[model samples]
Target: MASNGVEKVGVLIVGSGPTGLGAATRLNQLGHPNWLLVDKEADAGGLACTDVTPEGFLFDMGGHVIFSHYQYFDDLLDTAVGQGDAAWNTLERVSYVWLKDRWVAYPFQNNISALDKEDQIKCLAGVVDAKVANAVAQGKPKNFDEWIMRVMGPGIADLFMRPYNFKVWAVPTTMMQCDWLGERVATVDVDRAIANVINNKEDAGWGPNAVFRFPLEGGTGGIWKKVAKLLPPERQRYGCQLAGLDKDKQVATFADGRQVAYDALISTIPLDITLRWLGQSEWADGLQHSSSHIIGFGIRGRCPHGLKCWLYFPEDNCPFYRVTVFSHYAKKNCPADGTKLPTLCKADGSGPDSSEAAEGPYWSLMFEVSESNYKPVAQQPTKLGGSAVAAQGTWPAVVAETLAGALATQLMQPGDEVVSVYHRRLEHGYPTPSLGRDGVLKQALPWLRKHNIWSRGRFGSYKYEVANQDHSLMLGVECVDNILFGTQELTLEHPNIVNPRKNLEMKYTREPVMPGLLASAKPMSAQEN
Candidate 1:
């Protein structure tokens, strides 16, 4: 390790995310020691990290659940987070959509049984049109809005698809492209909808994540923290402020007057930031993204949110599009038994005004609200306390609306006491699959590759379809193979191939490890040591 000066390496990875960690892990397995990994965070889970409030409420960036298709990814999870049964909670996904003041088992189009007769008629008619259109329609969908109509028809689009998607993406369907939809969005089946509605049956098992697992203790962040540990300690650097990148000189300079030169560079940072560093910001001008506000509540009451894992809101009553019953996932999500925390406020904005603390058998709720050019959140948080209320929650004036929204949406009753309020704003949450995304990625990505730099991750690659933690991880693994042995990056180059089929290119199966024997055996990442 070069002490007081520049260091040169065979490969240099910027950002300690799944992508960076995946690359570092692969290189390590390949017996390559001349690689270095650096990140700005003190921790390894970039957007994947978890946060705890002063009152001991745990909140993730958003709701993250793992549904792996790659054996390589499955093996990495075991090596990091571990194969121990105590490390995770295997879950049966119980998701529902809030529509017309009733909870419909999710994939709204398929569960018309829960809808009113009027809605059922409307949706079924639309499905009929879609089936007819599918047979005769030519070329590809011009945009997401057209695609929705072509596949789901006008009735479903008007009643739920259009509004719910707009809330989640913070962009109208008309502005996005349909190519990234792959397995992410469910396609409406005409026969299934008709049968479910007529027979009064529910169809919830539609996607790959029909069953999933989450870390037993920490949120989704726990998995990445483990993977970042499998590299040489001395080569991993954390808390280093990245100043600039001189692409021409093949150098990365830190704010503290240190530099590293690399034969090949792998960046997991957002493409816009990377381009800006390389002094070519214009190439990424067409990119669009939505910001996210994670509003969490630690409550002191009977948990009204039952075994349902998460719920979606399409009505205007709530500021959030989705709310996860966080406490149901793990006991450690909230403060332990009898641990006292000051009551922040009630769900109805009533409270213990002073610094008065109380004990709990607590439960929590985590909400996600999206913002974009069309939908905006406040730049500055409004200075409001327990007695204050906003007319309707808009961005910036968050707290009052969030609380009121909870009450309005019936997630919380008027008497539900709020023990803790946790709010976090993430500037770049979801990468919009906009109509112009492919054009921009095509031009920018190939040019970067020409310079021996591979941008591959959520924002690095700028492909939302392949932006999950697993996909991001494989992008790094594949990029390394492409760098060293010229392997095809099936994950990055073809998301369609990897998203549906279980990629058994690499496979490992293990029986669940016994719990309690190693419950406290937490492995430290390379930098932590």
Candidate 2:
């Protein structure tokens, strides 16, 4: 990379995630050149990247959907992927929860009509009770469990909310705080529920991501790789992991002995790992997360369901909490229609391992299993992009169980041939909003900022509410603004304010007043919070 000596820059951005790219993109747009972005991985997108099977099928890390709340983010995406139908596949979000031997509409509380008569009655009663309780509920929920009870009542909570969330987070609802519950969970309307139940209707449109867009090719990774291409090539360095840090001297050493010192530092790495590199692991006491096992099954057949983009399974029958009908998103997700591949094994792994060549019209399903200290996955799924069946090592039959789970949940038939399989264990997937999270962040973030180091991203800030790509990008954008000028970081400091409203002031035009970024002289409403 760079020469042996330490190369000093005005600003050094670490980790080529959306957050880091946000800062770098802003700097480049401002025509500032005294900055560099470095990432250990060969590619950008971090956890947002897509991996390909040897058989030519593609699977993104997990189920990722773009739902923006900012005009700047929309502009950023359009600039990267090029605007219009040619660059994006804007599809309807046809999501269902596999429960009670049927595909029920999403936001289980709102679509009680899809359940059996008895269960529908129970859910409707719970919704009515929750409405009454919330009318007089004092203060805020003590925890996510309490919030669930107050919002949807115990029936929906026990059947769906509790079990589904536990599967996703691998953390008990009692231990999670409700402050991060702004636009995440759908709110149930008692009147709408009763009407839908009586009329046999489904209320599927409940959240912002009810409909989203994905890339037509290369999956989600295409977006970030394009964004990375937009920046000056000289300033971006890959394959250089941050080995250690000296906060006092503002110096960072890479794995290759290359070093960079900067007046201001922006790190998008996870806070816990960053602290470990800084040799202050004790400050990460409140940080906790669940590892994600992304399993993909590339099969040779037409999908039983049509236009069902993603499905959620809260029942114990499936090891995965959610499964995305990946091939439905884009034709490129699977191999070419006439391409031939071997039938490795059946989904249930019942047959003797065979290498019979097969042809396809292929469809794939991507699954996510959560693993944490509290609730662990049955096995550590094998690394992604390996052989379909050979990657299933001695670690408890994860691929086999996942296949069985899929059959039990009717995601696949008993004889569905597994043509291509892929698995990846992301060490830090979801950042848990534990009760003690605020206490640890208040202590750790300020300490890093005091050393002129700004840490911001999905795992960097450790706030799931602001952990989506758009929010993560804004965290970097605002953090740089905070560094350059004394601007307030609205996305980081106040998620509730940003989540609901449309923030449209940043057009990335014109210059600011002296000493600060009023860029465009058209002020962004950063002080709204």
The TM-scores, one per candidate, come to 0.91, 0.92
In order, the Cα lDDT scores of the candidates are 0.80, 0.83
Predictions: Cα RMSD each: 5.8, 4.0
Clashes in predicted model 2: 2
Q: Clashing pairs in model 1? A: 377-395, 378-395, 378-396
**For model 1, how does the per-residue alpha-carbon lDDT over 118-174 read when each residue is reduced to its tens digit?**
988988999898989878999898999999999999999998889989999999999
lDDT for predicted candidate 1 compared with the true structure? 0.80
**In angstroms, how far off is 250's CA in candidate 2?**
0.6
lDDT of 2 by residue, 278-348 (tens): 77777776688889989898999887779998899998987899999999999999999799887776766
